[model samples]
Structure formats: structure tokens, C-alpha cells
Target: MKMTVFGAGYLGATHAACMAELGHEVLGVDTNRGKLAKLEAGDVPFYEPGLPEVLRRNIDQGRLNFTDSYAEAAAWAKTHFIAVGTPQKKGEFGADLSYIDAVIDELVPLLTDDAVLFGKSTVPVGTAARLTTRVSQLARDVDVEVSWNPEFLREGYAVADTLHPDRLVLGTRPGGRAEQVAREIYASLIVDGVPLLVTDLATAELVKVSANAFLATKISFINAVAEVCEAAGADIAALSDAIGRDPRIGRQFLNAGIGFGGGCLPKDIRAFMARAGELGADQALTLLREVDGINMRRRTRMVEIVRAASGTLIGSRIAVLGAAFKPGSDDVRDSPALNVAGQLQLNGAAVTVYDPHAMDNSRRLFPTLDYSTSAMEACEGADSVLVLTEWPEFVSLDPTSVSDVARGRNIIDGRYCLNRQDWESAGWTYHA
Candidate 1:
């Protein structure tokens, strides 16, 4: 199958490359010339583990390409996947659908024949049906079917997730040809035992946001427990271990840390709540507001812990261990780690950050904060160390070596992944 994926950002780029890896010819289209140029040159604009190699291999094998023109993309492939961003609107919780709307507006007018547009962007419910009507209005003498096929790729593991998805969902109107087209596009995965759920368009649109909302709820639930444990002088790690052993409550996002943050969860829950309010079912999702609050409070708690550990943040040097939201990707949007670092910086603390892959992105997001090449370098003369993101390297750091470099042997484990005994043994005051 040959397909054009519009909006070549994180989701679009990964989907394009992974589609090519699945033995399809893929053209990634975007308005950003720099992003297109980077993709064409086999350089991924963002940090994703194993994505660069997959992209490079697919492009080198002549199965993947990129372009900035929607007309060219329309002419190139009958199948189009809209993987554009539907980020939260400024000063509002609802998603800004201008980008998704622009893709349809630009491409539908240029289509001269039959086409199928799979909306892979996470969007508000009923968007696909609305876009279907819009596509019908714009397309001339052509049969264009709009379907919802939301992506479930994680940032760090996007390549693996796309190449071997756990499930494939295709949402279309009754009697539409989208099912057949999607079957052909995902035939390999279907054969590999990836279950395909065929549903109405609205259900497909709801799946992605619902999944994110549930995951966010889970993280916040555990973080809320962490708060109780803090007040009770209990260890969250032990509690998590005991409860996680129960099969009904699997411990995936149960780690109680400076809670969930990324591009997706923070805005998705807010959007979900906002959408529910618009639908007159606002009370049902009211707990998500609490979830959002708990997540934000964790970052604040981290700042308080840092301030307490350092005695006084004013004129103090603090080493921030990670900047990205998580361990494997360089995405700092709504990152709790960066939020903590920023708060400390605002309070007159001189903060230095170190991350394996997120340094450049962190600098771009926060140019004022100082960054270091390595953890040791970041800790040099620091009053206290704050391990924010649980990067594996940070987890395995030699506390003795870090102690020698720091002016003060004070460490706060925001992620709760570090060994307290080891840090204490190294003569560092360990706080969780």
C-alpha cells in the first residue's frame, strides 16, 4: 500500500517510517520545510529511541519520502493518514482543530479521484463525522471517505508500537469502504495476530483520549497515595510492591513520583473534561480535575523538598537530573522535571540540568537554565541533587563519585527509583 501521512511531526514521522518498514511506500507531508528537510536527509527532528535507524533504513531503501505540498501528497497516494497535532487551545481545555481542519481543507480540494483519509490524530469525539461532511463539501466529482484510526504509539517506543501494534482500530460509517482499505493497509499486522476492531467513527475518536485519560488517572491515583504515605511516614515503594502483586491491579504506571507529564496526558485529561462539560456530563469526569491537581502538586512538592534539602534556595546550586518527561524521549512539554527546575530557578536557585537525550530540547524550552554534558558535571559544586526523571543512568549513578563532586551531599529522589541505602552509605542525605 502507498500512503501519504500529513503533518510530519512526532506521530506523522513515526507513522510514515513505520509504514515504510511494513513494506509500504510512504510520503510524509508537512508545512514545516525544516522538518521535511530533516526527514528527507534521514535526520529525525526529535529524539525517539530506535526511530532514527528505522527512518534511515526505510528512506535508504527507497520506501519512504517527504514533501511540503499537500497537492503533491494528494497526487501521490489515494490513501492519506492525517497524523497532525490537535494540541489544547491556548487559555482553554478543548483541542484546537485548526491543523486537522487545514489538512482536509488543503488536500480535499486537490483530490481528483477517489480517496480514503484516515484520521490518526487524537481528536475530540464526533470530529471524524464532522470532517466527513466537510470532505464531502470540498471534494469535486470524487468519492472521498473519511475514517478515524487513532494512533497508540508511545514516544520512546513509537517504532515498535507502530510496526507491531497490539491492536488496530478502524472507525467508519455504515457501508463505507474504509474497513477494506484499512485491512489492506494493516494486513501484515492482522496476520501477525494484532486484533482489528471495526467500529463507528465516534468510538474510534474516543478510544485514544480515553486510554490517555485512564493512564493519567492511574498515575495520579498512585501519586495521591504517595501523598498519604508522605504524611503517614510510610514508604510508597513498599506499598506499591504489595498492591502491585495483585493481578487485578497491575503496576505499570504505579510508580509514585513527580507525576505524569508529557504532551498527551496533561492536555488530554483537560480536553476530556472540557468536552464532557460541553456534552452536559461534566460531573462524570470531575475526578480528572483532581487527577490533574495531584499531578501538578507533585511538581510543587518536589520544589518544596528541594528547598528544604538545600536549607535556602537563594544563591544555592541545584543539579536537576532529567529534563524530559520520561526516560527514553526528549519531549519536555508539561514535563514535571522541567517544571520543578523552572520553579527552583524562579526562586533564585541556580539550577543545572543533565539528561541523556533531552538537553537540547530542554535548552530550547528553557534557555535560561544552565545545562551540563553529564550528571557528574551537573552536580559539580551543587548544594543538592534532584533526581527528577528516572533515566537508567541516573538510577545507576555512583553516589560516592557524585558526593565527591558536590559541595553538599544532599539528594532528593523525586522519582523514588534511587537506592536510599546507597546514597546514605555514600555520606549523602537522601530524601524521597
Candidate 2:
């Protein structure tokens, strides 16, 4: 199989490389020359565990290539995947679809033969139908089929998730050839028993958003319970452990922390709400507003915890232990860790931040805060050590060792990753 993936961002790059690894010839297209050059040179611009190796190996084997020309991409392959970003609109909850629109406007007109465009970016429901109409207008004599094949790759474990997805979904018009083409492209996975759910365009479009909404609701639900646990002086960790034992309510996203803030969850739920409102079914998803509020409140609550621990925010030095949204990746988009660091800085506290891979990205997003090369360096002379993202290094840090470098012995476990008994045993005042 031969294919071209548009947009060399996180999702696109990984999908392109993984497709090549699956024994398909793939070309990655992007307008950013710098990003394309990085991919060409076998470098991943962003951090994802095991991605650089897979990308470099595929490039070395001559199975994957990159380019900036849409005409060249259209001419090279009959199958295309749109993995562009659909970020939340500025000052609005709806998704910004200009990137997807650009891909359609640029590629469809240049198609010299029959093709199938599989949409991988998360978007509002009805986008596939809307874009199907758009393609009809832009395409010429040759048939161009539009299908919705939304991606469900998590940021940290994207490569594995892509290659061995729990399930595969294809949303296409009834009686179209898109399903046959998609089956051929993902034949390897299908042979391995990865369930493929074929559905109408509208159902496929709704699948990704609904999954994200459920996940966000689960996370916020646990965080909301954590709020109750706080007021009643109950141990959330123990309560979570006990409730998680129930076969019905699993404990996957139940970790009571500063809450989720990545490229997907925050924007996806908001877009889901905004789209529901546009469809006049806004009342159905109204509780998501409270979910969004609960997630954001956790960040503020973390700040309050720090303030109370320090007794005074003015001139306090706070060492923030994580900058990325979650461990195993360096993505800081809407990161709860960085958000807390920024808020602490605004409230007259001097903040030093450290993350294994997110430091460079965090610096670009937030330049005012101090950055350190090591966790101990960030903790040096700090009034309180805040564990924001539960990176393994931070979770396993020896409290006694950190105590030697710090001016104060206050430990705030925002992610609930730290062992309270060990920190308390080390004579440190612990706050989770």
C-alpha cells in the first residue's frame, strides 16, 4: 500500500512512520520546511517515547519520505490521511478547522485520479459530511472519496497505540469504495484480530469526540470526589483504591491529581459541548461545563495548597517538578503543571521548573519562569517542592536527598504519585 499523510505534527509524523513500518511506502507532507527537514534528517521535533527510533529506522530503510508539495503528494499516492491540528478556536470553544480546510482545498483540486481521503484529526460531529460536500465542489472529473477514520492515539504511547490499536473504525458514505480501501490499508492489523467497525459518516465523526468526552468526565469525576475527600478529611488514595476494586468502576483515570491538560482532552470536551450546542442538543452535554470547571479548579486548588503550606506566597521559592501534561512525552499544551507554575509566579512566588523532556517546550511557552537542568537543582533553596506531573524520576525521588538541598521540607504531591508515609517519615510536611 502507498499513502501520504498531511501535516507532520505529532499525529501525522507518528502515523506516517508507523505506516511505513507496516511495510507500506509513505510520504509525509507539511508546509513547515523546518519540520519537514527534521523528519527528513530522521529527527522527531517533539518528544514521544520510542518514536525517534521507529522514525529513524523507517527513514533509513527508505520506506518513509517527506515533502512540502501537495501536487507531489497527490501524484505519489491515491490514499491520503489528514492528521493536521484542529485546535480550539481562539476565544471560543469550537474547533478551528482552517488546517483541515487548507489540506482539502490544496489537495483535492490537484488529484489526477480516484483517491480516498481519510480524516484522522478529531473534529466536531458532522465534519465528515460537511467535508464530503466540500470535496465534491473542489474535485474535478476524478472521483475523490472522503471518509472519517478518527485517530485515538494517546500522546505518551502513540506508536504502540497506532500499530496495535484496540479497534479500528471507518466512517464512509453508504455503498462507497472507501471501506474496501481502508480494509486493504489496515489489512495487517485486521488479520491480527483488531476489530473494525464500519459505520455511516456521522457515527464515525461522533465516535472520537464521544470517547474523549467520556474520558474527561471520568477524570473530572474522580477529581470532584477528591474535592469531597478533602473537605471531609478522608484519604482519597485509600478511597480510590477501595472503589477501584469494584469490577464495574475501574481505576484507570481515577488518580486524584491536578487534573488532565493535554492537546486533546481540554479542547475536545469543549468542542464537543460547543458542537452539541450548535446542533441544538446543548442541554444534553451541559454537565461537561462542570467537568471543564472541575479540571481547571484542581489547578487553582493546587495553588491554594501551596499557599497554605508556605503560609505566605510573597517571595516564596516554589520548585515545580513537572512541566508537561503527563510523563513519557514533552507536550505542554494546556499543561496543568505549567499552568500552576505560571499562577504561582503571578501571585508573588518565584517558581523554578524542571521536567525530563518538557523543559525546552515549557521554556518556549513560558519564558519568565526559571528553568533548571535537574530536579535537585530546581529544589535547591526552594520553600516548597511541588510534584505537578508524575514523572517517574519525581515520583521516586528520595525525600532525604531532596531535603539536603532544599531550604524548607514541604512536599506537595499534586499528582498523588509520591508515597506519603516515606515523605512524612523523612520529617517533611506533606500535602497532597
* TM-score of every model versus the real structure: 0.99, 0.99
Which lDDT tens digits does candidate 2 get at residues 160-264?
A: 999999999899998888999999989999999999999998898899999999999989999999999999999888988999999899988889999999899
Question: How well is each residue in 91-205 modelled by candidate 1, as lDDT tens digits?
Answer: 9999999999999999999999899999999998889989989999999999999999999999888999998889998899999889999999999899999999998998998
Taking all chains together, the TM-score of candidate 1 against the true structure is: 0.99
